[model samples]
Structures are given as structure tokens and as C-alpha cells.
Target: MKSAKAKATNYKACLALEVPAYVAFYKAPPEFLGDDALTIEVKYQGGRTEIQKITVKVSAPGGQQKI
Candidate 1:
């Protein structure tokens, strides 16, 4: 029984929370990144859910690569 504008309507959340219904895409892997091994795909369109991975660790000095 927590209606009535939920106490004057005022709520907040953290950790980038935004995916009401559908819409979650981040395509950024085309900026002269030779070797071609860096890609981040986070898409959600309807049922079948299980997404929680955003890794990107590219160390310098000619070593380390996890994307």
C-alpha cells in the first residue's frame, strides 16, 4: 500500500541503472585499433536474460590484453 506518488515521488539509484523495457547497446570498437581484438557488446532485446560483463583491460609495454 505504498502508492500516492510513493511519498511525493522521489527515488534514486546507483551503478548506472537504466533499461526500462528494451534498449542497451554500446558499440565502440573501430578507431584504428590494430590487431582487432577489442569489442564490447551488451545488447538486450526481450526474453532470455543473463548479462553482467563489461571487461576491458589493455595494458601497455607490449603485453596484457583482456577485452
Candidate 2:
């Protein structure tokens, strides 16, 4: 069995993608969802609005991870 500290460390290393808007939608039926998987609206440098979608998969860590 893993030690308590080791388990805590392992969980800390794991990263989860959290999108407040998509949380509720993800729980809903797929038919009601839109084409965009995960979208984040941000204001660019010059007061321009832009929408960006990031595709991510939840998986166990084997090697290095991206931020």
C-alpha cells in the first residue's frame, strides 16, 4: 500500500481541466451540447474579444505533463 504522504503527493501532481461554463453542460445530454467542446472567451490585447476552445483528455500521468 502507498504511504499517506505518497498518495497525497500523487494527487497533487495530477492536473484537472476545470471549465466553469462547461461543467453544467457536460452533465447534460450530448444532444443538447454544442459543437465547441470547451470554449473560453477572453479579451485580446486591443480590446478585441476572442473565443478559444481547448481539447483535453483526462488520463493518468506517465511522463512529463503540460501546463
Candidate 3:
């Protein structure tokens, strides 16, 4: 994504626990392949911000794995 922004949503889980949650759906670039680096910025409801780095792995279709 060229530029993306996200907002955290508050959810009430079991036992009356309040938690911040986020859900994202994205489509990778058509020309993208192999391993790529993804950076995400998380903003909580308490005005807390965090930077997270994650790895995005892409592989060929029907690729076989050696035991």
C-alpha cells in the first residue's frame, strides 16, 4: 500500500475484559513475490502508538516441500 492508516477498535471480551483490537485486509501487489518487509503502525485508544515490523512471505503456486 502506498499509504495506509488504521484505527483501533475497543472490544469487550469474555470476563468483562476490555481490549484493543484491529483487523486489516489487504491485497499484495501483483508483481510482488518472495519475502518482503512490512511495517505497521498501531494506535491504541489510550493514545499509545507503536511501530511493528513483520515479514511477508510469498511463494509459488503448488510448490512442493521436501520432508
Candidate 4:
């Protein structure tokens, strides 16, 4: 499927009775460690918009490994 970018103000006249669905994926680099964050902007069909910030912590694996 193709993705299109549209402005929220353009759909101000539109409305939705049901919630929309979204799919997202995230992966950290193998050498990455410490604090990470993700910022997300959500636009509703009614033209309302919301911004969310999520923080994530990455640390080295603990415990012993057996062969």
C-alpha cells in the first residue's frame, strides 16, 4: 500500500465514529546503550491532534551464558 501525507486542518470537516488503527515497529542497534526516546504525533479524523513522548532504556545483558 502507498502512504500519503495530509494536513490535519484539511480534514477538519470530517468525522469518524470508530477509532483508527496504526502499526509501528522499533529496533535498537546492537551497540546502542543508555537512554532513548520516541516522539509520536497522532491526528484524529475529527481534526484533533496529540503529541506523545516515550522514553526507553537500553542496557547490557545480565547473567552468564553457557555453551
Candidate 5:
């Protein structure tokens, strides 16, 4: 199997979501591998707060993977 480092450069990072929802995906640049995670914080109008975060992993070819 190929290693993540070898295939990392050929991949593209992206985030897609509908509006009015405070959900998102974050892909870090290759240089920031040590901090390979995405952080998202949402704040409501009434001082209420919500936060969601996820680790970013490299995706391989030939298989369907969900982000």
C-alpha cells in the first residue's frame, strides 16, 4: 500500500455545506501536518455558543470516502 505522505500532494482539500447551518469542514495545508485537525466554533446571536471539530485524514484513491 502507498503511504499517506506519498499521495498527500496529489489531493485537494475542500468543504461543502448548506447555509443557515453552522457546520463546516476544514482541510489544513500540507505544511501544517503536525496540527492536522480542523476547529470550528459557532456563536449565536443571543450569546449562545456551539463548537464542532474533527481530525483531518488523508484520503486514498479508488474508494468512496465521506468527508
Candidate 6:
């Protein structure tokens, strides 16, 4: 387990990629979602663990759609 002292609050994030692509994560102020596959996991300092998986199709801005 990773040890981290609690101040006012704390944050935890981890990323794993099976196939190589591109990934971007936004936090606070101008937060945004992605248009591709991603996985999010949240574990308390020493409590419950919650995970979420998102699947999305991606394409070029002005390219032909996949059929």
C-alpha cells in the first residue's frame, strides 16, 4: 500500500495502457471528458475502493466515420 499523510485532503491517480495511444486527464477549473476508452479508480486513504470504466469511439475531427 502507498502511504500518504492526510493534510486538508489528498488525491490519488494511476494510469495503465494496454495498447499504445494518447491520453489526457483534466482536473479542476476547466474539467472535460474524453472521446476514447479509459478507466478511473478511486481508493480512500485506508477505506473502500471504487472503480469506473468508460468506453467511447474516437475518430478524426473531419475524417470518415468507421463502418
C-alpha lDDT values of all predictions = 0.42, 0.43, 0.60, 0.63, 0.49, 0.47
Residues 1-67 of candidate 5 have per-residue lDDT tens digits of: 1212212232445244322333354555555433356656777789999886766555544443344
lDDT of 5: 0.49
Evaluate model 2: give its TM-score. 0.30
TM-scores for every candidate against the unseen true structure: 0.25, 0.30, 0.49, 0.54, 0.41, 0.33
Q: Show pairs that collide, candidate 3.
A: none
**Sort by lDDT, best first: what order?**
4, 3, 5, 6, 2, 1
Instruction: Write the residue-wise lDDT of candidate 4 on 1-67 in tens digits.
Output: 2244433443556653333356454566898877788888888889999997877676677733221
Better of 2 and 4 by lDDT: 4
lDDT of 1 by residue, 1-67 (tens): 1212213223364434433343333443545332433333445567555655555553544665655
> What TM-score number comes out for model 5?
0.41
- Which candidate, 4 or 6, would have the higher TM-score against the true structure? 4
Q: What value does the lDDT take at residue 1 in candidate 6?
A: 25
Q: Kindly state the number of residue pairs that clash in model 4.
A: 0
**Which candidate should be chosen as best, given TM-score against the real structure?**
4
Where in model 6 is the C-alpha error above 4 Å? 1-36, 62-67
- Prediction 4 global C-alpha lDDT: 0.63
Sorted on TM-score, best first, the list reads: 4, 3, 5, 6, 2, 1
- After superposition on all C-alphas, the RMSD of every candidate to the true structure, in Å, is 13.4, 13.1, 7.7, 11.9, 13.9, 14.6
Residue 39, candidate 2: C-alpha displacement in angstroms? 1.0
Off by over 4 Å in 4: 1-20, 62-67
| Candidate 3: regions farther than 4 A off | 1-20, 63-67
